[model samples]
Target: MGIISPGFFGRRRRDVPGLPPGQHLTEDFPVLSAGPTPRIREDEWEFTIRTEAGGAHRWSWEEFITLPQEDVTVDIHCVTSWSKLGTGWRGVSLDTLLDSVESTAEYSMAHSYGGYTTNVPVADLRDGKAWIVHQFDGSALAAEHGGPARLLIPHLYFWKSAKWVRGLELLRHDAPGFWESNGYHLHGDPWREERYW
Candidate 1:
């Protein structure tokens, strides 16, 4: 993506700087979810990031909007052979959410209201690497595509960037997530084609 910000990890490792290996680019953003869509009202939404030892930061839908926000253009690669390029999103950076929390956790387990969880290295979320997005293409995100808010970590396979995100639990050690525990790779990198363990 030409709009990729400086110091993005995916850019640092590649020369071609386009789609990852084994993924075909697509313009249409597909709607994929593990189960039925959950309709969440804005007044009832909440997001939290907590450390295993107990420090936590939480925001309601209203509070979340008051924090700093930015627009991002990214190329997203899904594990199912589809890559969507030049996707636009608006949200708060994960860096902001973890700013006040004092913790030394190296891993994070993203928890969704629907009981879905995905794990990722905490380092991957800092310094503009990840976001919790509520808007897509300048419009409010649809319920089918994870409304209210969803984690967006474009560097990894889309599954790692979970939908319907509600809270994040920082961990001292690495752990497999839903798909990872069920056969998907622990660390999914589309370029390496790490779709499964």
Candidate 2:
């Protein structure tokens, strides 16, 4: 795994002042790095969550949108060395989603397109540090940037905030995600600068 040094927290010339303290900024914000966006119809968009037992629930775009939404300000650290500070996002909390499904799993993983996945603890999920984001900077998410819905994890490295997130898979054990399997750090903590193993 590789370590990242985002030039945030007033460390970078372009750093903004809206984020909470101790948050740093990364060099670049690759809005379209994942490539061209996909064409997804609202009628076809579905978000599902499954427990290890395979018991699952699905949400149509309409149903998902019907859930309560909240405004959040979080710091993001990317594996590529860029941090977006004080990013304003509006979306449903993981707890809200879990409560909707009445989840029982103690741990969880988020899976997205491009074979991307990230492991997370239920405690993090319940802490309001994450969200199924629909809007960024007060605008609807663009596809290249994981539109429709993406997971926003403030505490962990940005990769943990999986983009183009299709659903969350509840797990009984912790499993490494795409980057994790590829030598990226398991737990990316910015304060200690723990970007890799």
Candidate 3:
């Protein structure tokens, strides 16, 4: 199962415009994780994308920071039913990273530093839809909030935005990750209320 917080059983969903169904607005950026937080040093951090054809494109912390960066202001929704709107982030677009790799794979498995994984379609990750964000709200993202770098796919449920993201493995078919294997929805689209199998 994914991160589950207490008090989720009885809260009423608010009928707020621009909010997903069955979700309520939240002003707090809650810290919920499947396990203990891993503290990674910046100097040792790296990101990679391994193609289905066995090709790998990698970047060290120094190299990644040198890539083009964008300021993104978007709304984020958590599977736990909390939605925070108009959050600010700065990072490199997934398009920029994918431009260097050549692959025909349609799926990807995002791997984080602490054994966490999540599957996302390559189509959902491209065309200005996603980013690998390192900063949140004008400051370095806190460790509890995915720290050095995290995948930021705000259009989907927050879980798709894997924190402490390390690399991505392009695959020929879709496969469930940590949460999906345990019965979470395969494609976690917040707007559609696709929260469970």
lDDT of each: 0.90, 0.76, 0.94
Task: Rate residue 171 of model 2 by lDDT.
Answer: 83
Per-candidate TM-score against the hidden true structure: 0.90, 0.81, 0.92
lDDT of 1 at 96: 90
RMSD of 2: 5.1
In the range 74-160, model 1's lDDT, one tens digit per residue, is 999999988888899999999999997889899999999789899999998999999999999999988888887899999999999
- Decoy 1 TM-score against native: 0.90
User: By summed lDDT, which 10 consecutive residues of candidate 1 come out lowest?
Assistant: 8-17
Off by over 4 Å in 2: 1-28, 32-37
Top candidate on lDDT is 3
Total clashing pairs for each candidate: 0, 7, 0
Clashing pairs in 2: 6-25, 7-25, 8-24, 8-25, 9-24, 26-82, 26-83
Candidate 2 lDDT by residue in tens digits, 117-184: 78887777886777998898999987777887889888877778877788899888877877777787
Model 2: lDDT of residue 173: 81
Worst 10 residues of 3 by lDDT: 7-16
